[model samples]
Target: MSITSAERRSKDAIKARIKKIVQKRQSRRRCKLSDEELVLLALANSSDQWLMTAQIGEFAMSNSFFQKQAAQFLFGRTSLHASPQGIGSLPSRIESYLRTYGIPVHSKVDDENNKVYSMTAGAAYALLEGSYKKRSKATEKKLTTCPLLEIPIEIRMKIYHLVLKVSGFRLLVGTQSLSVYDDKITTWESRSQDALKMPPLNNFLALLSVNKQVYNEAMPEFYHENHFQFRDMGSMKNFLHNIGSERRKHMRNVSVSYYNLSAAAAGARLLAESDTLQKLTLTISATKDPAGHFTVNSSRRRFSSLTQIPGFSSMKRLRGVQQLVFNPRLEHDVVDAFLRPIITAPKPSKLSRKKKSNKRKRKHSELMSNHEAGQPAVKVSKIG
Candidate 1:
């Protein structure tokens, strides 16, 4: 949820009004408010409905010196001590004066046996309805900046996960990087559980564009956690290439079903090198003309084109988690051959590059010696 500029202006106006009332009421009480005005001001401004003396006092103390004058007015000194009488009597005095002025206070005992106070509904509504007397030093506002990066990394990751996780649906990303809409064609596709939990794709993706630090931290939480579905292989290639090859390492679960073969080769080339890809599903749509039939030569050519994409070499390797589904009409034997997984096994250390280099150096030295001695140089076989 977000506040519009108009909503923010309204909230600021309400705060200004409340501050004005607090100042006017303080003047009415002849500058001996015993902390009533300050307590009212704090309660009105707080996001929390109910707050204790310690919470209110902490709020007041953290504010400007002008605000702290209430505590001094109550304690008859600059600083307050934790005497039983000092802390205990302050809220009672504040509550007593506030009630007499018809600005109601709702009091309840917290688990700690201390008073938790909030404004009554009527008083709160009345505060918002009134007009502020005038703008002055008392109503000056301070802008607060959030220290997002200062938060602990573990906590930040939890926040990122909570905000970014989308389950039970695939993000239908197109050439625009994303395209979500209602289609009368499908029943359950419209009410996607996981995607709805997130903001609109554009809004959610804007989180990545915030700054380098936020982008670095949140990018993985989004890309790695969600299953992305593409309209065609071209969009998939565009998304991966535009985000950069380094970020493509996070491409885990992805699906693409395409009628056109234009993007097949480029998309496959990216996937071949994108060693981090865990799960992939590729569904090749049946290609045909408006008449819904293909000539023998055309069908053969079409099958040949599909096999060339990502090529047998790259496909025989793998995208770990992505399940590639080929056209049922296509040859299962050829498709199965391509989809077969393979991992490169390291060669024996004895056949390492250092030994190969040394062998070449030795052969060159021997040939030089034989030539100098006017003898024929023996041919050396190439190292396997």
Candidate 2:
């Protein structure tokens, strides 16, 4: 085991070099800024920006990568020791350092007597430029993966319909004066009335704007599922025109209110053009007297004119017509009597043929009886 002095010196040198490298690495690790320090630096650099210690702790905790560093800063060997009484030991230590650095601190006592800390103007600026911006970008990147877009198209459409479809009819009314469209003098009055209040459609519009493919899938579900109500023919016409022909094909149920026959006729004509419309609920406003009979002369006249209007007459031509509901306020039997001829199939002429057959049988029986009685043969004249 005996060694030369030169050999011993060489071995000693190697050991000393290794020890130095280990010491350097330890020093570097110890000197590294803790999460609390980074947060303080961030708050200090933000001029006039205030933050509570709890908020800082929350931020550090939420970013799990910084959790250990924050713990080390709060309770490590270099941290301050304070009494466990009054205002909390941890916060007291933090406050002492903030004061030592001459970093202006604002303290507010809450209802529970807990102190909240905030940075004032005198805190030293230590955070590097773009640090906050980088953090914000990182957070935003984490939120960009939307689960909604990942779902199957059929499921997404169902969800969209659930969200966008109205529970009942959606009323579309005009807020301005009405005007003629296509040179027709429609009975739909001035459109300058307050429309019925409705739930917001902004969410549906926002969903549609997500992308072109999403818009294509959701638009049909939104239009096809809900029943649309229009105050008059003019408003319905405007709505149809605005939605364009492509979307119009998805429209199915429509409810319209008309003050006059002309308006009803006009609305019917417009609805007749919609190839997809299956149900039409026509609401006619007819004022009644104390006896429950229609009181307005104009109303009676308009009701009679319903059958005469070209648009009203053409309702039979609507291939998709299924249900027609008149306002329940009017007499159902009376209305049915009038509309039965217009909308129902014509009856067969079986009653007239049965009556003629019975008469011929009666005449033959009488002639047989007379012949059996031995009466002279009476000449029977042919009845036309």
Candidate 3:
């Protein structure tokens, strides 16, 4: 049959509405909620509360539509109101309830092990109403045992600060590597170049991924003093690639062994990128190779190239550098080169004069006694 344009447009509109209705029906089915169930659910969720639908079912055990009411209360009316799978909809329903009231629920699929329902005092009060007053009061009275977010902000901040202070990055443990490195040390080999090739900073950074809070808080400290093992050139390149210039600015101390000179050079390059490195501690080993076979020729090499790096040159202004030590092999030249700038930096005249004046005053006071005052004393003329 030939249809008129107006009739065709009306048919199209009807089809669109039907599609929407079907989509909505499918959605409700996914969440497993019904109309009458939704009304009860809304009343149950009137307060910002998180109770499992099973708890609501227990609450309404006498009701004929307990299963339906529990399902609706737990999930919410989705388009799937026809055959709502209440048991399957529990998680989504709980999520919906929490999100609807703007409450932040720390939910995890892994949280199945700890089914804790956290809520504010006011929310809890509203949820309990007068029905569970005594039990709610008893529960709330034990607020001292609650988590930080459960407490007031001021108390929470103090608690967070304490946690932060106590939860700083622990010492990096390289037991296996240290054992191997120690063996090389016993052989009197220069191992700095090899050590420089493998950096340990990445391993330390992995510690941050242990948990969410740790990632948030310990990241800065973890990267603050990035120490690269420098066992190979690969580790050196990895550190440079992973830790960028801006982050290196927070770097204060870099410990490089003689075996990992490449790593040291990479580190020096990385440090040189940062204008904020205050100190560089070189842990030069007496051994030369990985297996500890020979001694590296110290006179043939120097970290002078590091001084030329942009980051290292600016390191002089960082002000916290108080000491530098070189292994006996490079002690004469390397130690000299490292210390020369620090030693050459200007000393305060006030401090020198103060020390001299205090010494002279003490000496004179020691020599002078009440009985010695009776003897004539000869004063020397000032050369000035």
RMSD of 2: 23.9
Model 3: worst 10 consecutive residues (lDDT sum): 165-174
Maximum-TM-score candidate: 1
Query: Candidate 3 — which residues are off by over 4 angstroms?
Result: 1-222, 225-237, 260-264, 285-320, 325-333, 339-384
lDDT of 3 by residue, 159-198 (tens): 4344332132222223334312332232225334233222
Candidate 1 residue-wise lDDT, 1-384, digit = tens: 776898677766777766555555454334423355567666777633789876777777665554447456545564556442455567767777767766667789888886788864335536434423223333443112236677899998898887776655567777443543332223224335232344666755776775688878998888778767776667777777887777777777766664345565676667666655666655543344455432221234434343454333454555344354444554344344435444222222555758998989998999999999999987768999
> Which is the better candidate, 1 or 2, if ranked by lDDT?
1
Scored by lDDT, the top model is 1
Candidate 2 Cα outliers beyond 4 Å, as residue runs: 1-149, 175-198, 260-266, 285-307, 331-384
Quantify how close model 3 is to the true structure by its C-alpha RMSD in Å: 19.1
- Cα-based RMSD of the predictions, in order? 18.7, 23.9, 19.1
CA shift at 117, candidate 3, in angstroms? 33
| Alpha-carbon deviation at 215 in model 3, angstroms | 8.6
Per-model TM-score on C-alpha atoms: 0.43, 0.40, 0.33
